[model samples]
Every structure is written in C-alpha cells, then in structure tokens.
Target: MASQDVVYTSTENHAGFKIDVVQYQPTKRPIEDRFSVSTKSSNRLLLGVYDGHGGSHTAEHISNILPTALLSHPPEKHAQIFRETDHTMIRAFTRDHSLLRPKSKSSDWVHHAQVVRAGCTALILDIDVNTLIASYANAGDCRAVFYPPVDAEGHLRQTEDLNAKTPSEQQRLAQEHPGEDLVVVSGRLFGRLMSTRGFGDACYKLPHGTIGNWQHRRYIDALSAVKESGKIPMNSQYHAMFHTYRTPPYLTAAPEIGTMQLQKDSFVIMATDGLWDCVSSNDAVQIVRGGLEQEVDNLAEHLLHSVRATRAPGDDVTILLLHIIHT
Candidate 1:
C-alpha cells in the first residue's frame, strides 16, 4: 500500500485573487483526499475537494477529471456538469471492471478491484465574477462554511446563526430518489460506508440482485486478501458484514448543487468530513475568524490541531479557505 504524505499545501490565483488550500493526513491511509482550483474565461472560478474511502483511486480520478468537464461543458447550466461527471464516472468504472473480469484469476484483477471499489465524497464551489454568487455541489458529508466578519466589538456571532444562514446549510434536498436520505445500518453509512452518496463503490451502488451480490462478495474477498498481506490496514469486515436491504442503487453519485451570493469581508471554508468530525461549525468559524485576522497559512494547520485536541483519532483532513476579497 502507498503511504500517505504527512502534509500538503498550495495556493491558487483565481481570476487574479488567491485561494489557499491545506491538507493533513496523520494516518497511513494513502492521503485519499484530493482538491482542485481552476478558472475559465477570466470570470469563472471552480474549486473542489474530494474525500476518498475504501481507496484513493476515485478521489484522484475526480480531482483530475471533474474540472475539465466543467470547463468544456456549455455554461448555460452549471449543475448539469456535475450530473455529466457522475455519469462518466459510472461508465468509466463499469468499463474498467468489464475489462478486468475476463482475467479475474490474476493478481492484476485484485488490484483493479481495489481501485474500482474505492469511493469518494465531493464538494465543489463555482464562482462567477459577474454575478458575485458562489454555486456549490455536495455529495456526502464534506462541508462548506462561510464566515462573515465579526462585529466592531471583535466577537464572532454564534455558530448556529452563522451556519443557519449559509447556503450550504440552508439548501434542502428535493425528494427525487429513495436513497437521497442517509440510511444507517449498524452505525455505518448504509451499514458499510460513511457517505450516502459518492463516486465509485460500484459494488454498493449497483442494483440489489444476483450480479450485485456476487460483486459485493468478490470485493470483500479481495479486500481481505490485501489487508492480510499487510498492503493496507483498513477494516474490510465492516463493509463486508452488511448488504443493501432496500431498493436498488443504495448509494448515489448525484450531487446536491446550490448557490450563495458573496459578501465582502467574509470567508468560505471547505473541508473534508475529517475536520467536521471533531470541530463544530461554530467552533470552525471562530478558528478561521482568528486566522483571517492573523495569517491564512495557519488556518488549515490550526483547524487540524484543534481537531486533534479533541482526542478523537482523526481522518484524512483537507481544508480550502477562500477569502472573498473582491467577490
């Protein structure tokens, strides 16, 4: 198994403004999270963060492909881009599985299964300079928190009031599919994963039937072999112990997309669930509020430290802070 890098940091200039990103992976899980920031036509800014589980292939693939899809697709409707990306991911993973099935006896097939069964939760932010609105797409629990400047007295508002009004928190899910609401089986997401929607995890996303059931078993066996060989330490039994008991397509890649108007002297923080697992939304805002007053580079590090202080074993953590300087 590939070992994770301890920390990663970078800054991007989005339409002449800066967006800083930071990631910390204290565990040895291959740093299964990925992020991207891109621009188009000098006005549109696209930013994304992907948190992967089971494996990193899905997150890495989306981080590399989703931005290009957005840029090349017609701008008439941006949400459609996320749908297109989801469809493409399904097609790509299906094709890869088909090509490997014929050679299932080979070690290559096991490795391919490891990669194909990987899942990734995603959060995307699209900003158009002309409108001063930030469009967001979320699949799974990765979150985006926007913090307006504190009052002249130098105190930030309570977490509930700030988060209650953020676009990410207010967007309601329109009923469309059965699995849209999170389902828990034995405290695990769908009883196997932590996310209800994401890319990859084809074994879980497939319709419940003979073929899907067979694939699930195959994945479990492969994962066990990898773990026993010391290739990875991730617990495969939790996922193997449960099966989809409800309708077909127990998990989805469909993204929840919405928009938020930007305001000056405010900051938007996007991060993987790792951060939220320990820090509350209000606490996170307070931390960033202090960071903005001091330095941006310390924001990510500070958040990670705070999460660690909670004494909970942390997950792979990634933070993207966008200070709305001119938006």
Candidate 2:
C-alpha cells in the first residue's frame, strides 16, 4: 500500500484576507486531481480545482494553463475560454497521428490516448480583492460553498451540479440525443462517465469521422491498441459506448458562471468531489465555521483532518478555503 501524501500551502496575509489549500492523496496511483492559485495582482486572485478521471494528464494540463487563460480573458469570456481550451486539447491530439503508427509500442499508444480519453472537471474562482467580488465558473461536480450562506434577496445562491445523476442534466442529455435510449443509464453518460461536462475526454466529445478521415482512423487504431494492451478491460462498457456513439459532443466544457459579493468573516470552500463524497455540504460549512470561530491556523487542513476521522478517503481529496477578515 502506498502511504498518504499531503500538501498544504498558505498565502501571505493581505488586508486581513488569506487563502489556505490542502490536498491528501491516499491511493497508489498518481493523483489525478490538480489545483492552482494565482495572485495575479493586489486586486485579482484566481483559484481552480480540477478532478481528472481515467488519468491525470488532463487535470495537470488544465491546472497549468487555465489560470493563465482565465487571466488573459475578461470575466465575461471565461465560459468561452473553457470551451476553447477543450477544443485546443482535441486539436493537439488529432495533429499527432505518428503516435498511432503500427511501429509504436502499445504503451506509447496508451500514453497518447490519455490526451483524448482522460477528462477533468474544473471549478474556477476569479476574485476582485479590492471590491471583494468573486466570479465562479464550474464545469463539473466540483463545488464552491460559502459559509454564512451567500444569500441574494433572502434566498441562498445555488449552483447546479453537472453530472448524469442530476435530473436536469439527465433531461438535457435525453433532449440533446432525442430518441437515444441509452444516453444515460444508471446515472452515467452511456453508463460510463458520471460527469456530463468537463474538459478533454475527446472520445466522448468527438463525433465519428468528425476529425479528418485519416486522423479519425488513426484515433480508432490507437484506442484498439490501448484495449489490446489490457490497460482497460476488454469487456468494458466503453466498448459498447464507442460502437453506439452517434451524436457527437455528448459532453461539454462550457462553465456555468455566477458572481457574489463577499463579507467579512465569510468563508468560501472550493473542493473536488473526493471531499464531498465523504462530507456533506452542511457538515463542511460547520467545520469551517468552527475553525474560524476557533481561529485555527489552517482551516483547510483542519477540515481535511475532520473528514479523515470518519472514514479513509477512497480518492484524492483537495480543499481550498478563502477567509475574509478585518484588520
């Protein structure tokens, strides 16, 4: 068994505001989750959490590039940025057909396939420090919750979860596919992926022969190599999914964006599903609230410890906490 690894970081105190981040990796496999924090200037701060499935490649790539991409574009263009980034990833994979040549090793093909088959959920928060306004964009199940509850005109602000299990998401898939009965089964997209929106996972996003004929053929060949190598089970449901893949772009990376004004002592927690799987939203808020009341040194780390006490995490857990305070 591999030992658990934890990463913790805290930013310098700025006008009594601070951010804390922590990640716990317990699995033997390389952690597929990635996160980033960019204090671009005194007035701007960017934070993101990416949860990758199938492999870590997509998450790592997004973590490295998304912060910069978001910073380059205006806040209104963030959704377009997410979609363009997904397209860029697919284009990069299609341009490298040499990896699919017969002479290439199966392992080589598998590595290249990661660029297309792996996908990641992204949740980004762009903050205007001086104004204490935060704009959030979410693409998957990763969640951002505000302590003391960010209420708008007497109602709590809510963000929908973009996954097959969500009723509206299921309805959207059915409506998009029309008569496709298997668009969702057992609360999964084609009974394979839980996320209905994210970056990468080109195999799910690209339609048959959408890429040039030659490139699509090479893509199929690479997938066959990956299967033959037994990296994935031969009888996996994905086999059926590929054969039945009719409508292209069964998933999307377009983020749902919203903004809120911050208040002193208000806390925002952004985390991957790994933490949410074991911790309830209300419980998480209480934990953070308690930490703040007690003036803990690192609230993110404290919340992580609280989660581990109940049960060992089955996946990589990441937590980012932003605390607003007065000097």
Give me the candidate number with maximum TM-score. 2
- Looking at model 1, report the run of 10 residues with the lowest lDDT sum: 157-166
For candidate 1, lDDT tens digit of each residue in 1-327?
Answer: 112434787766565455777787867546889998877888788889899887687788788888888777544455676666666655544444452545445565555555446778788887877776777777777888766634686553222211212333323221323443444434455445656567776655544346545554544454455442345433355344444333445556666667776776677888887777678777888877777777756566656555566655368889887776664
Task: Show model 1 residue runs off by greater than 4 Å.
Answer: 1-6, 74-79, 95-115, 149-183, 208-246, 295-298, 306-313
- Summarize candidate 2's per-residue lDDT along 90-180 as a digit string, tens digits: 7655555554534336554455567566789999989888787889999999999876664565443445668999898888888888988
Shift of residue 126 alpha carbon in model 2, Å: 0.3
- Taking every candidate in turn, the Cα RMSD to the unseen true structure, in Å, is 6.3, 4.0
TM-score of 2: 0.86
Candidate 1 lDDT for residue 315: 86
**Which segments of model 2 are wrong by more than 4 Å?**
1-15, 98-113, 150-158, 210-217, 223-230, 233-238
